[model samples]
Structures are given as C-alpha cells and as structure tokens.
Target chain A: MVAHPTRDRRAERREATRAEILDAAWELARIHGLAGISLREVARRIGIQPPTLYWYFDSKNAIYDAMFAEANRQLLQLIAEQEWPTEPREMLRMAARVWVAFSTEDVARYQLMFQRSIPDFEPSPEAYAVALEILQTMRVDFAAAGISDPAHLDLWTAVVAGLAAQQTSNQPGGDRWLRLTDEAADMFADHVLGTTTQESQR
Target chain B: MVAHPTRDRRAERREATRAEILDAAWELARIHGLAGISLREVARRIGIQPPTLYWYFDSKNAIYDAMFAEANRQLLQLIAEQEWPTEPREMLRMAARVWVAFSTEDVARYQLMFQRSIPDFEPSPEAYAVALEILQTMRVDFAAAGISDPAHLDLWTAVVAGLAAQQTSNQPGGDRWLRLTDEAADMFADHVLGTTTQESQR
Candidate 1:
C-alpha cells in the first residue's frame, strides 16, 4: 500500500503551493478585507493561472478556512505562553497585557481572527477546539489565581476581547483605553484574591 | 435681499430629501456592509434614479456622514436622559447596560458608528463636536461618581464599544458573552469606586 515516489513528491509540491497561495491571500485580506478578494486575484498574486487555483483548493472559503485556522492557532499559542501570576490582580494584569500586546503588534492577524465578515462560514472542528482550548486555559488560570466565582472568568474574557478589538481598530484614545483596561485587570485580580480591601485603602 | 418664496421652499424640500436619503442609506448599510452598497442601489431602494441621489448628497461618503451624525445624535440623547448613578461601580454598570441595549436594539446604527470603513474621511467638525460632547458627559459623570481618573473613562468607553461590536456581529457564546460583560462592568465599578474589597468580603 506504499505510495509511488513520484506521486508522493507531487502531493508534497501541491501542498506547498497551496500553503503559498493561502499565505498571500491572508496578507491581501488584511489590507482589503475578506469581501473584496477573489480567486482570480489570489491566483494573480500567486503568479498562477486562475484555473490552476482549483487544483489545490476548492474555493476561496477553503483558503480562508486555512488562514483562519492558522491565525487562531498562532493566537492560542501566544496565550499559552503567558506566565500566570501568583497574585490575582497581577494574574489578570499579565493576561490583559499579553492580550493587548498580541493584538496591537499583529493587527492584520488579529483582524482575521476577530473582525472580518464571513457570512455562513463555520470553523472546522479543529479550529473551534483550538479557540475553546485558549478560553479554557484562561478560565483555569483565573481559578488557580483564587477567582472563586466561575462567572468572573467569562466577564474577564469578554473585557479582554473587547479591549483587543478596540485597540486594533486604531480607535481614538488608544493609550487611555489600554490604561483603563490595565486598571480593570488590577481591580478584577484584587477582587479575586481577596486583596481589594487592602488595595482600596491605599 | 430677501430670498424668493419659491427658492426657500425648494431649499426646504432639498433638506428633507437629503434626510430621507440618509435614513434609507443607513438602514441599507446595516444589512450589507458599507463597502457592499452603492449610491445607485440606495437611490433605487428610495424610489429615485441613481443620478438624482447626487442632487441632494454628493457621494456615498456624504450620505454616510449624515447618517453617522444622526446616529451619534440619537446616542447622545439616550445617554443624556439616563440619570447618573452616585457610585462609580453603579455608574459603569448602568452605562454598560445602556450601551449594550442600544447596540443590541439598533445594531445597524451601532455598526455605522464603530465598525464602518472610511478611508481618508475626517469626521466633520460638527460630528467631532457631537462625539466630544458625549465623551465629556461621561467624563463629568465619572468625576461626579468620584472616579477622577480621566483614563478610566476612556477604558469604559472602549470596553463598551468593544462589547457593542461583538454583539452587533452575532458572535458565538451569546448568553455567555453578555453575562461576562455584566460581571466585568461590576468588577470595573468596584475597582473605580473602591468598593470591590468591601463587597467581595461581605
């Protein structure tokens, strides 16, 4: 049942070409948005005849699926690397800083994950699982930091998500926005760690 | 030097026509992303020839400007009517609820404010003034609630804007997202008002 050597080489080459096309499409979408892109345009960018694109991927959605999955995977990896703090307030602060820094540093990648319009598109189960894993990690981290109420984890995630979205849009008052978010993270942490009274008195 | 009566009447009608066109365009942009719309399509929806649209508004940008102004005006009016809470935490919670409800109810209008793409479009001075006034009111309210840091006001605005953007897009984890937002608001309020410690201990 071993594959022929020529067939294996051809498959590897095709896979490499598909990856190249997807990478180009991802860059184009970041600048022009998902709605304005087309298969012909993607092929042109990849220096291939438009019809040749079909040989590697079925449709634009498939390429998007690949790019989206890659972007989400990268983000989840970044989140996983954050150091969870021993203090509740510090823990939330670290998470907030990491989230904001990741979004601001990689604007195009961040938009693909959160901001684009793709109607009637469902993520592959693997992509969804990766996204969920990131969220779950944050929840476990919060609990370990002494956040007794499971509900607070959800709120923190939303706040963090919201902060990322605002920061990436180049919205007005950007610095102030981040500062406020840091303060919020601090507050949430203190509440979780039962240090609010001491912190408040200061 | 008085204008002719007919001239004045024509001018009044022109203003009314422009307003009507803007209203229609705003609704249309909501269903179709701003980039997906065209002046011709908007005119057709309003029962007019495409060229006739230019008689009142010069371009889609002009129409968008008008619609943006109107939406901001409505938001300001809504915020103005709400009584300010004396406690900082309460104030944030109240603001969060109002902001979320406004977005959830008039999603199209909300998206027009925060998510629309406007290349090289500087908001008109009048629009800027209106937006400034809205932020000023929030700042004053925050000050009154003893949350004197100007940065916190900006963060609250970003969080609210972020939440609105998420809700408008119909992102996954609907109920969970909302509940998380509510908790974030409460935690933010406690932090700002120096109440988190006292409340959590109780």
Candidate 2:
C-alpha cells in the first residue's frame, strides 16, 4: 500500500489534539477532584465547543480511559528506563522507590491510575492491559527472589502503594512516607524471601 | 450554670438536623463521588433552601469535615467494639479483617477517611485527632506483639491499608484482596516479630 502523506499528517494532528485534551483534563482534575471533571469545562479550556469535544472523546469516561492508558504507559516507560539491578532484592527496592516517586509527584494521576476515585470510570480493557503488563513485569522480579506466591505480589503492591498513598495523602511534598520506601520493600522482601532474621533487628 | 430544659430541647433538635444533613451528604456521595457532593443538592434532598444549609454547615468543606469526624468516630467505635483476642498476633489479624471489612463495605467512607480524594478538603483538627487516636490504639496492639519500633507500625498500616485499597479499588465486593487480609497481616507480623520460618513455607 502506498503511504498517503496528507492522511498521515491529518492523523498526526488528530493524535496531538487527543493528547492536548488529555492534558487539559488532567489539569482540571488537579484543580477539581478527579470525579469533578466537567466535559463542558474541559472543552472550554481547550478552546473547543462543548459538542465539538465529542469528536475527540465520545464521553467523559472515554477521556478517563485515555488518561488511564497514558498514565500506565508512563509507568511502563519509567520501569523500562531504570537500570534494574541483577540482585532480586535490590530490584524490588528500586521498583518501590520508582513507584513512590511516580505516584507522589502527581497525585491526580496516582488517584486515577491506582485509586478508584472516579465513581463510574473503569479503564477500558485495552488500557487495563497496560496495568496488567506492569504487574507481570514486577512478577518476574518477585519470582527472581524465590517469592513465587501470587499472594505475595498482591502484598507487595499493597505495601508499596500504601507508602505512596501515605506520602501523597498525609505528607505531600515530604518524605515521611517516601523515606520508608527502601525499608518497607526490604521488610516485605525479607518476609517473603524467608530472610527475616537480619531485618527483624530494624 | 443552671440547666434550661427548653434550651436543651432546642439544642437537641439542632444537633438532630446536623446529623440529618450529614446523612444526606453521605447519600449523595454514594451516588456521586465523595468530592462530587454539592451544597445545593444536599439542601434540596433534605427540603431546605440552599441558604439554610449555612446554619448547619458554613461551607461544603465543613460538611466534609463533619463527615470526616463522623467516619473516624465510627472507626473508633468499630475498633472499640471488637472482641479483641488477647493473643497479640490473633488480635492483629482480627484487626486486619475488621479494617478491610470496614473499608470495603463503604468505599466513599474509606476514601474520605483514608484517601485524600477531595483535593482541598482537610479535616478539622478535631477530626484529625480522632484519626491519630485510631493510630495510637493500633500502636498498643503492635507494642503488645513486641514490635516496639514505630516503623513497624507504619509498615503495618501500609500493608493493611494497601489491602483495603486493593479490595476497595480493584475487587469491590470481591474477596480477592479481602482473602489476603490474614496472610498480609501475618506476613508483616512475622517479619517484624521475627517469626518468618513458619509463614514463609506458605
């Protein structure tokens, strides 16, 4: 098939507009609560008529789905970019640090991706697949440490996310909870890895 | 001061109205997101003019504060009412069950109490004091298990809150995360208490 230059340019522009709409929605979410996003307001901010906004996103929930996928992709990129250590325990700790930093930096994004703050917004399957991929990536890290139980993965997520939630919720712009990241990862890691004797001293 | 029966009756009615307003707000939150609540909508629900709502709550955030305090008080009551096991480890596990149940039962309440979902809503000092008291009560439990380190308490909270967050966010009305409550609690418990050999086998 021959490449159509004009159609390619048009598609590029459309994709850019979608990104703009998503960025504007995130800005509104930061100001209003996540669920507080109004489509009319979003349209107004992006200099589009309220009805015209539908061309890009059919509904507010559609916008949410895009944002969900975008956030997860950023997470995927972050994980991919890290020079992950070969030592499994160190890798787990590094993952915790990366997640906490990512979550606390943009609380609105964190709530959207992790916290179910939006009442009716469930990520579309395509978007949710990205989240599952992130989990699978972490699963391999846990498996490397000889912690193969699925329950431990659930526990690992709870611990690290709890740290992020605490940091974002209680001590925003502070490290009270963020500072606990390494220790928390080590604690859970040691617990599941059956190496508790040394860590118990802490 | 001398008791005034008529004044006391008037005060009782005023308090009753306040409770009614809070209940209405909670109803709205269940339907809408927690931060999606509106002062006007609340007034309409309870058959009062929007302006009249000021008598009970000076602002929407005030209603949120009242709700925050009320939610924590309920948590405090829930903890107080538990038939806490004398065995520290048993008590800890029991506490996890209670918390995850309390949290997943009503996600709106959990978000208000635990999650900073409402961007600008900060609980009043009195309300936060109740939250702190809940933490202090749990501290006694950790202390009983000979886990005197405060970091352990933070880890325990992260672990448990993570479970609640997981249950409420990922598997609402499902036991996927809820079923992990005892194991999650025990993982952290044994990690801090130095009893990992038995649990790691799982």
Predicted model with the maximum TM-score: 2
Local accuracy of candidate 2 as per-residue lDDT tens digits, B28-129: 988887877888898999899999999877888999999999999999999999888876678779988998899989989998998888777888899899
Candidate 1, position B1, lDDT: 100
User: How well does chain A score by TM in each candidate?
Assistant: 0.81, 0.90
DockQ of each: 0.45, 0.58
How do the residues A1-202 of candidate 1 rate in per-residue lDDT, one tens digit apiece? 9756655877788889988898878777666655556788888988999999988877777777787788778878877676666765666788888887776665556655666466535667876677778777777776776665656664565567677766656563255456556776766566555564447536
Worst 10 residues of 2 chain A by lDDT: A193-202
- TM-score of the second chain for every model: 0.83, 0.92
Predicted complex 1: DockQ: 0.45
Candidate 2 lands at a TM-score of: 0.86
Name the top lDDT candidate.
Answer: 2
Which digits, one per residue and each the tens of the lDDT, describe model 2 over residues A1-202?
A: 9765656887888999998899889998888867778888888998998898889888889999999999999999999999988766787889889998999899889989988877778899999999999988878876876678887788888888888877777777888888889988888777776675447535
lDDT of 2 at B41: 92
Candidate 1 lDDT tens digits, B51-115: 99877877767777787788889889999899876655667788888887776566556655665
The list of candidate 2 runs beyond 4 A from truth reads: A1-3, A36-52, A196-202, B1-3, B39-51, B83-86, B196-202
lDDT score for residue B92 of model 1:
75
